[model samples]
Structure formats: structure tokens, C-alpha cells
Target chain A: MTELRLMWRNTRMVVLCAISAALYAAVLVPFKVVPLIPGVTELRPANAIPIVCSFLFGPAAAWGSAIGNMIGDFFGGVSPGDLFGFFANLFYGFIPYKIWEIISRGEGPVIRSPWIAVKYFAACLAASVLCADFVGWGDNLLALRPFSLLGNVIIFNNMASAMLLSPFILAAVYPRVRRGRMLYEELMPEIKPAPMPRKTLGLALLVAGEVGAWITGNLLSTGYWTPGFLPAWMAAAPYDKSVAMIVSPFMLLAVVGLCLM
Target chain B: MKTTLYIERDSFVHRLHPTAKVFGLFVVFWSIYWVDNPLALMPLALIVLAIALMMGAWENVYRFRWFFILIIVPTMLTWMLFYRVGKPLITLPPFYVSEASLMFGFGRGLKVGALVLASVLFLSGTKVEELAVGLSRLGLPYRLGFTITLAFRLVPLFMESALTVVDAQRLRGYDFDAGGPFERIRRYVPVVVPVFMGALRKANNMAMALEARGFGRTHRPTSFIEYRMHPRDAAAFAFLLALGAVSFWIYYSGLGAIPTG
Candidate 1:
């Protein structure tokens, strides 16, 4: 996460960040591979760009993903929910490389074997779930859309791109980036990983918190399960109060976990 | 493709200080966020329309006509699934169409539509540089703001190069539209790889160019354009502040809420 701040100090990292964002918005605006939710979202192959860039550019990719999505939102429509969308994409790009760093034990994200492939999928899934949860929880909190609708669709949209497109892109681009000595670790060697025990615990919390938020968001938004602790008024239809009450702590936990990592 | 929503207009809205415009954007979103009644949302919609008409931003608005429709319709339908209140006018399996639900859904749609319109107006009126300057004035770091402005400048370039790659591939008898949705997306790998590699090849030189020109030699690098607050800007800020206050008052008075009985 320190890299996120440090990347700004280096001119090359700033250029790389701009390039990453430009590539994302370029692919995002013109290409609508599949429209999953009409105006809200689509199955964007462009989603893979962040994951690919994340493996290559580290923190730059995270900011790139956020800003790129902001550019895309400008073209489509911007809303208060897009503030959430921004952070959602930030995590979407941030989580992959961080998780990969831990799970792969400092190895590159180019998938060369079955075990590596599973780890790759896990990283993408974690990223996708948190992204979906953030957007879903936000829309539902605002009473704009049901959490289940966005929560579920975005996961599918992100995963579709990650699973089907990102690996191929990474496999093709990683070695060349490494050869050019342009990978984040190569560009900014000052960044040191946290102790393994803390990072592992952070990973555990991240997974648990994200998964909990997803399930709780879905349940609360659907009116399937209302927690008894909330007042009756808060538990009523639209369930905005219920969602704010129940889902937010999990989201906080996830953020704290990311900070730890 | 035209990558940005900005139009080169010399309207009063365009001439306003970037910080005021940025704050205006937040005020609009803040105003819209407090209401969930279609009727109540109409005033802001009409205000946006008036601004658009005043600024001759109808071109961008007209361009996004279908998108506005798409946003409104699906949003209404999606809320119908979850906002089950009032007497059922039409009871379907998953959807319960009631007066409250219909009004609530329409209100949500209008709210989202208004937010989008406000954003479109903002983007149409504001340039990328102005946005960065506005954000910087509002406390964004200089480097991050520069990165954002640079990314905006690069989107069209990247998109142009990507289209060139697609054309070259097509000339070589490569079919981009040769299969199902996922297959079609997968086929973009070739197009993406070249653009990705091309972008990276520029990164080193771009960094060197910035460094040679003293990119980060100082904390607050001077800009080519300078902005100062005017009487109009102060007036606009006051108007926006009042608008935000009125919105909160509406919410507190419960005039913005849907009657779900």
C-alpha cells in the first residue's frame, strides 16, 4: 500500500500509471462485449486490463483502474454510486497483485502450471467479489438498486473477463515487461513486503470480510433475512438502514485488512 | 472515437472557476441523493436541462439519449423486484407491481437519471485540465492530479492505436467477430497485446522526457493556465450551498420520501 503513495514520487511510475489508465479507458469506452445490465454495467473484456496491469505495474494499476473507470463513468453517467465505483475498481486492481504476491511467494503472476492457475483464479475471484460487494452495497444503501442485482452481476462481469481474458494477456505481456525491467518491483525496489505472519492474517481477514459482506448484502437487499437488532423501521422495505448497519462493518474490516497487507 | 464528453464551449458555465464547477458537481449529487420521489427529482432535472440549453450542451445530451433511456427503464424494473410495498396492482412471481413500488421505482430511476445528466453537463462544460485544477484546489495532490490529466490526454491516442491494431489484424484475415461473446472477447488478445506492448515501449522514454523537463523538482509545479475566483464563482458557490441545504431540508421534512403505504 505504501507503493500506492510512493509511486507518485517517481516520474516513470506516474507515466506508467497514466498509460495504464489510458489503456483501460480506451478499451472501456468503445467495446461493450456484452451488456449485462443495460446502462448499469456490461461484461467488459476491458476489465482484464487492470488485472494484467496489476501484475505488471502494481499500485499504479490500482489508481489506473479507479481513474479509468471514472473516465468510463463520465461517458456513460456519473452518480454518487460512482464514488463507490471508483474505490471498488481501485480494490479490483489492487487486490490481485497483493494477493498474488502473498500466494505466489514473490513469483511472477504468469501462470505456468495448474497450481499457479488456481492461485490466479483465487486472486481474481477475491478482487471481483470485493468490487461487486462495494458497488452492490452502495447502490442498495442508496436504494437505487437491489444489492443482489448488482452484487451478483458485477461478480460475473469481472470474473468473465478475468478468467477468460486476463491470464492470456498476462502470459503474453509479463515476460516482456520483465525483460524491459519495467515491472513494479523492478521500477521501485524500495518497497518491502510486510512480515509473512501479518500479511497472512490480513489475507484471512480480507477473504472473510469480503465474503461476509457479499452474503450479508445479498441477504439484506433481498429482504430475505433482517437482523433482529435493527429497529423495526430500519428493517422495513428498501432496507437501507439494515444494509448500512449490517454490511458496513464487513466493508471496514476488508479495508483494514488491505491496509495491513 | 471521441474519448471525452467535453465540448469546447465558451459559456458562462465553462468560464467559471474549476473549483466552483467541481463543488457544483458535488452539490448536484448531494441534492439528488436526498430525494426519492419522481416529482421532487423533476426540479433538478429541469435545472440541468436549463443549464444544458444555456450552454448549448444539447449535443452531448442528445448523444447520450439512448443511455438515459437505458438507465431509467432498467433501474425502474430492477427496483420493482425488491421494493415490494403498498397494495399489489399486478402480482407476478418475482415482481410485485404496486403503486408504491411503481412510484418508488420511477423516483429511483429519475434520481439516477438526474445524477447522470448533472455529470454530463459537468463534463461537457469542464475540460480535463480544469478538472485536475479543480481537484487540486479541492486538496488533491499535484502529482495525482497531473497523472489524471495526462491519462485523459492519452485515452484517444491509445484508442486510435488500438483501432489501428484491429485494422491491421483484420487486413491479415484475422476475424475479431468470429465467434460467441466469450470467444469474440478472447480474440481481442492479439489486438490488446500489440497496443499493450506499444504503450509499454513508450513508458521509459515518456518518463525520461518528464524527468528531463523537471517533472517533480518542486511540490507545486507552475501550470500553463491560472485560475482565480470571481464574483460569479462566489455567487455560484453560494447558490450550490443553498441548493444542498434545501435538499437536506426536504429530506428532513420527509417531502422527498416515497409514500409507501
Candidate 2:
């Protein structure tokens, strides 16, 4: 909520938002030709923009990415896809910043070592999984596409393209941004402190539940799993339904646990 | 800077309110997906194309001719080979493309083409300032609307800056195209890093400029422009609403389903 408030109170953040959106669209619009999956997904190095911007500019990047995607859609053979595209992109641009606080553990972004590189990689993977899952589900609802294909394609495309390019970009630009004193931590001085243990545990459980649900849902929908793959107690129940039933409890527990904390 | 998509033309489409055009876009987008029959999809595609032609968007469409062919051709082939369910007409060792799938793919291609045409028409017809006015009137905060408009305005500036960075890197003896894929990507680091740092500097200067102009002093800033709904705009909205209702009815009734037998 403070992030939202800061966007409104600090006029500078609004300018940052505009810059993020423009940069995103500029990267995306030109690359519309490089479609990896044709009508479903594309070769978007533009994916790197959101991940990079989120780290540098913070929550304003989320709003900027969402709006920029809508505009970029106009030039990229526009579709109702933006209905999901907007939210998926918001996640793409927002999650890294939000997760960075948790993953970085009160430290600023630095990649002078292998361990720090792994942390950034994990955060990128998590963001990619979440965004792809949401977009895959939405595509099924709106376009009657099966879930497995879009899910995997988006996950591969976004994760591979963004991750492959982002660390290099991050490493190259971070020092300069830090020197300019324009990094998000510098711009927004009232950064939140490290999370409490309860919050951390809850977040971990929530992420696990969602990722588990995504994998199980895809496997079940595609009929790729065998009964022998499941335990006897769970084999009789349909995998999709059973996975949802079991994992959803963890999601509920996460929310309740976070609230109590 | 060459920023906007708007083309100078006097036509019915160019005269409508931006909100009405946005609504029309929504109607077209949703309805296109609801159609399941290849034959039924053709008319919808034609309707969109005809509108674009009437609006003098043929020149703009011609500019993207190669893009359309490249995207739509592969999209059609992909669906035919991998997606549509039917007896195989053409089979390779691991893949089959069926007759039903071909038409199905063609229908999907048409849907994509229609959408691209609709978006081109929308962008070419609506000015950025008018879009901002329409968004503000549609209940978005004027400040956020201003940010989106500013983003649109800045897109060309950023693109120019990106080009300049690339040129500067080339002058420094960095061969952007000389190496294999990975090495070429590595070479781009110099270009991307500098452009991003330049952007951060520009953002800081922009923030100072906005502060100097007393931007955030008032909670509600007054705008010099306003969008009003004319009678024609109201009629356009009514037509779009009716189209949406009919499309939904057809979808729910399965009136547009392809006959399998």
C-alpha cells in the first residue's frame, strides 16, 4: 500500500512509470516479427525490459509494463490476449522487485559472485512461472486453448529469453545506476525492512503450492502421468482435482498464516 | 520525434470518439474468438478489413504486408500440423496435417489478420491526446492518464537514444554482428548498458523539470482538453453493444460451430 501511495505522492515516480512503459513498448513493437510460437507467443527479448525495469524503478514498473503491453499489442497483431497479457505483464514487471526484497535479505542488488547470480536466477524463474501460469489459464478461458501448451511455451520463452539476457544487462547497468543514485533503493528511501519469519514461511508455502498446482494441472490436462506415478491413496482421485484440493489448503494456510503474523 | 501511430485522414473512423473506437475494438476482439467455423470467421475478417480500407488505412496495411504474410502463414501451418483434431491428410513420420485442420488454421489466421487490421485502424485514427482524454473520462485518474500519454510521447525519443547508443558502440570497434549468436548478444552489452544509464540520467532531469513546474502541488490538475460524446459516437457505441450481445448469443448457442460430419 505504501508503494501505491508513494506513486501518487512522489511526482517523480510517475515520470519513471512513463519512461518504463515507453522503453518496454519500444523494445516490444519492433520485435513483433520474431514469433517463436506464432499466434501464441513470440521471441521477446522485450521480456528483459520488465525484469530490468522492476529492479531499477520498483512498483511503477508494474503499471508501466501493463499499459505498455496494451499499446504494444496494437502494433503486434492485436488480440484479446491483452486481457491476460496486461496482468501477466504486471506480474512480469512487479514480481522481481517484490521478490527481491525477500530474496536479497536487506541487501541491494550485486552480482560480483556466483551465489548472488543464483538468487537473481531463482527470482526470475519464480516470476516466469507465476506469469506463465496465469496467462495459460486465461488463454484457456478466452481462446479455448488447452493449458499445457501455452503454459510450457510461455515459461520457456520468457524464462529463457529474459534470464539469458537480464543478468548481463543487470550486471552492466547496476553499477552505473548505483553511481547515478537513481536505483529504486536510492529513489525510494522508505524501503521495507526484512520480512518476519512467519511471513517468509507463508510466502514459501504459497509459492510452492502455486508451482505444484501449475505442474499437476498441466500433467493431468495433458494425460501424461500414470497411476503408478501417484500413491495408492491418491491414485483413484483424478489428478487435477486431487492436486487442486491438496495444494489449495496450503494457499489458504498461507493467507491465514500471513494475517496472523 | 516520430512517436504517434495516427495518420492524417478524413474518414468516418477518424472522426469517432476514442472511447467509442475502443469499445468497437472490444466488440470485434471478443466476437472473433467466439466464432468457431472457418466459413463464419471469414465474414468477420472481411468486416474489419473493409472498415480499415474505408478509413484509408490501405497504405498502412501495405506497409505491414510482409509482416502479415510471415505471421499468418506459420500460424496456419502450426495449427494444421499440431492442434486441430481429425484424420490425417498429409503425414510425415511424426506429424500429420489434416483437411479440417487446414481450414481451421486458415480461420484462425483470418482472426489474427482481422485483429491486426482493427488495431491499425484504431491507432491510425486516434491521436495520443484524445486517447488520454478518453482514458481520463473513463474514470482513470488524470495523473495516471498523463503518464500513459507521456509514455507514448517518449517512445520515439527512447528509440532514437537506443540507436545512438548502438552507433556509438559500433564506432568503438565493437562488432555487433560479427560473432555467433551468444557472442553477438554479449557484444550488445556495451550498447544496452549505456542507453539504460542515459535513460536514468534523463529520468532524473525530467523529475527536476516536473518539480520546477509545480506538477504535484494540486491534487486535481486541470486539463486544457476534454472529450465529449457526440451523437455519432453514441450510435457507434450502441452498434458495438448490439454486436457484442449478438456475438455472445451465437457463441452460447454454438451457432458458429463447424460441422464435423
Candidate 3:
């Protein structure tokens, strides 16, 4: 609530949000032609923008990422399920800053140590999985494609790009911003802590959810079980197989994310 | 070379109200999904193509023809293979092209084609400012619209500066091309960091400038321009609504379902 108030009341935050979204979109638009799954997925190096900017500008970056992704989708070719993309990207952008605050213990977000790097990477994976799940469910709801396929593809694409690029981006930006005394922490007279407890239950739920996905994926793959509730289109061939293949990595990531938290 | 998605044209499509175009985009996309028959999907592709032809998007289409060959074509082929089920059309020793696969493939393909065509037509014909105006008319707060439009305006500027940053790095003997994937990504650190910092500084300056000019000083702000619905826009909206209704009716009536056998 305070974050929204800060964004709305402060002219600086509003401009920052606009800049973050525009810059994020601008960086991403050129990559529109490179299709990972044609209409379904693309090589989005711009995912790094939210990961980096969230740490730098907080909620402004989060809103910017959501709006920017929607704008980018418009330029790239807006499709039916892109409404999901908008909301999914909102989580993608917002989660990192909050996670960073929890992990950083108010020392601020800089990946100077191995532990910090692990936390940052874990945050990236968690954000990617969450975004992918949201987007995948949206696709299924709209009958755009099978949810599992879209989810796996989105997760792989976003995680790969963010992991590959964010560290370098953060390493580069941190020192310079600090030198200029322009870091988000520096600009604000007081920093509000994120919503409480930060660790126990949320981390536990995330682990349990990912473990469940792993189990479901394995069962579907082995043909030992098939979910009766899913529609024929969604439960059809190759989706179950693909989901099985994809879940292991996410489960591994869940463990890593749990440790980071 | 300056990269731009918008094509310069003065066609009737360009003259249509931006709000109508934005709304019509959703209607058309929704209509696309209700279609499951391959043959029935052709008209959707054709309508968008005809609009593209009128808007002179063919040249841009030709220039980006690789997108169709590389992305769209492969996507169609993949769907055909995966959904193979009906009477065989062609046989390779181990695989058969069947009616169900062909129909399903073409349907998905045409949907993608129509999506791409519509995006090209709309984006080429419309300006970002007009999009913001359309959004505002649709009841988005003027401040939000201004922020979005402002973001759009900044995209080109940021892209240009990012390129400049890349050029500067190249001048510093940075070897971005010779490395393995990870190494190459690491090389981008030099490029992305400076660009991000530059953007941050620019954002700060822009905020100050906007604040000085009375940005966010009021709860409601007046705009110098407004978009009024024209007779043509009304006709366009009616046409879209009618088409969308018919499509939904056809889908519910089972006329557009793909036959498996």
C-alpha cells in the first residue's frame, strides 16, 4: 500500500516507472523476430531488466516491467493470451526486489559473495517458474495451447536468459550506481521493509508445490497415472511426457530457492 | 540502420480511430480462437492480409519474410506432426501426413498468420501516442495513459543510446563475438551496464524536469487533445462485434470443430 502511494504521489517514482517500462520494452522489441516457439515463446533477454531494475528502483520497476511487457507484446504481435503475460510479468518484476530485501538483510542488493549470488539466482528461478505457471494457465484457459508445453517453454526461456544475463548486468550497474549515489536505497530517505516473516511458510509452500509438480510430472510420464480432470486437448500426447522432462529441473531449482530463502 | 516497427502509410486503416483498432484487435483475436477448422480460418488470415496490402505492409513483410519461413512455417509443421490422426495424405516410411493433422496444422498456422498480419497492420498504421489516446478514451486514467505514452516515446531514444554504448564498448577492444555462449553473455556486461546507468541518470533528469513542469501536482490533469468516435469507427466496431458474435455462434454450433476421422 505504501509502495503504491509512493508511486502515485511521487513524481519521481512515476517517471521512473515510465522509464523502466519504456527502457525494458525498447531493449526487448528488437528480439521480437527471434522465436523460440514461434507464437508461443521468444528469446527474451529483457527478463533481466526486471531482475536488475527491481533491485534498483523497487515497485517502480515492478509496475514498469508489467506495463513494459504488455507494450512490448503489442509491438511484437499481441495475442489472446497476452493478458496473462501482463499479469505474469507483474510477478516476474515485483518478486525480485522483495526477495532481494529478504535475502540481503537490508545490506542492499549486491551479488559480491557466493551466497548472495545463489540467492539472486534462486530468486530468478522462482520468478521464472511463477511467471511460467501463470502464463501457462492463461494459455489453457484461452485454449491457446496446452498449458504444460507453454509453461515449460516459458520457464526454460525466461530462466535461461535471466540467469545468463542478470548477474553481469547487476555486477556492472551496482558499482556505478553506488558511485553516483543514485541507488534506490540512496535516493529514498527511508526504506520500508517488505511484508513480514519473509521465510518460513512461503518457502515451505513453494517447496511443497514444486515437489508436487515433480511427483505429478513423474507419474504422468511413467503412465502410472493420468489426471482425469484435464480436458482432452490439454491431457493429450507429448504434453505429459514433456511435463515430466521439465519438472526435474524445476524441482532442483525449488531446492536451491528454498536454501536461498 | 535505425530499426522501427511502424511503417509510414496513409491508408484508410491508418485513418481509423486508434480506440476502435485496439478494441477490434481483441475482437478479431477472440474470433480467431472460436475457429477450429483449417478451411474456416483462411478468411481471418485473408482479412488481415488484405488490410496489410492496403496499408502497404507488403514491403516490410517481404523484408521480414524470414520470420514466416523460420518461425511460422516450422510451427505449422510441428503441429501437423504432433496432431497426426485422420486419413493419410502422404507417407514417408515411418510417418504419414493425415487429414486431421493437416487441418489442425493449417488452422493453427492461419491463426498465427492472421495474428502476425493484424499486428503488422495495426502497429504500422498506428502511432504510440494514438494508442495512448485510445487507451485513455477506454477509461484508463489520463496520468497512466501519459506515463505509457511517455514510455513509448522513450523507447527509440533508449535503443539509440544502447547502440551507442555498444559501439563505445566495441571501440574499447571488447570481443563479444569470439566467446562461447556464457563468455559472450559475460562480454555484454560492459555494454549493458553503461547503458543501464545512462538510462538511470536520464530517468532522474526526466523526473526533475517533469516535476518542475507541474507533473503529478494535481489529482486530475487536462489534455490538449482528445479522440472523438467517428461514423467510420462506429461502423468498424459494429462490424467487429457482429463478426465476433457469428464466430462464437459457429464455434458453439460445432461448425468449426476439427474432425479427427
DockQ of 1: 0.85
Model 3, stretches more than 4 Å misplaced? A1-6, A31-44, A178-182, A185-195, A198-200, A206-225, A229-261, B1-4, B80-97
How big an interface RMSD has model 3?
3.5
| Top-TM-score candidate index | 1
Interface Cα RMSD in Å, per prediction: 0.9, 4.1, 3.5
Q: Which numbered prediction scores highest in DockQ against the true structure?
A: 1
Clashing pairs in 3: none
For each candidate, the DockQ is 0.85, 0.36, 0.43
List candidate 1 segments past 4 Å from native: none
Clashes of each: 0, 0, 0
lDDT of 2 by residue, B130-206 (tens): 77776666677877778888888877777787778777877887766675544444455565566666676788789
Q: Candidate 1 residues A8-89, lDDT tens each?
A: 9878889999999989999999888778888888879899999999999999999999999988887776899988999999
Q: What ranges in model 2 sit over 4 Å off? A: A1-5, A31-35, A38-42, A144-146, A190-194, A220-261, B1-4, B81-100, B217-220
TM value for model 2? 0.85
lDDT by residue for model 3 over A1-261, one digit each (tens)? 246446656667778788889878877876342457755567667777888888877777877888898778766566767787887777777667766666666655666788887888877776777777666656544534545556677777777667788877877777776787765666665656544554544565555655465445534433345567666554554353345344545544544443334
Return model 1's CA RMSD, one decimal. 1.1
Which 10-residue window in model 3 chain A sums to the lowest lDDT? A237-246
TM-score of chain A of 3: 0.76
Error in Å for residue A95 of model 3: 1.2
**Model 3 chain B lowest lDDT segment of ten:** B179-188
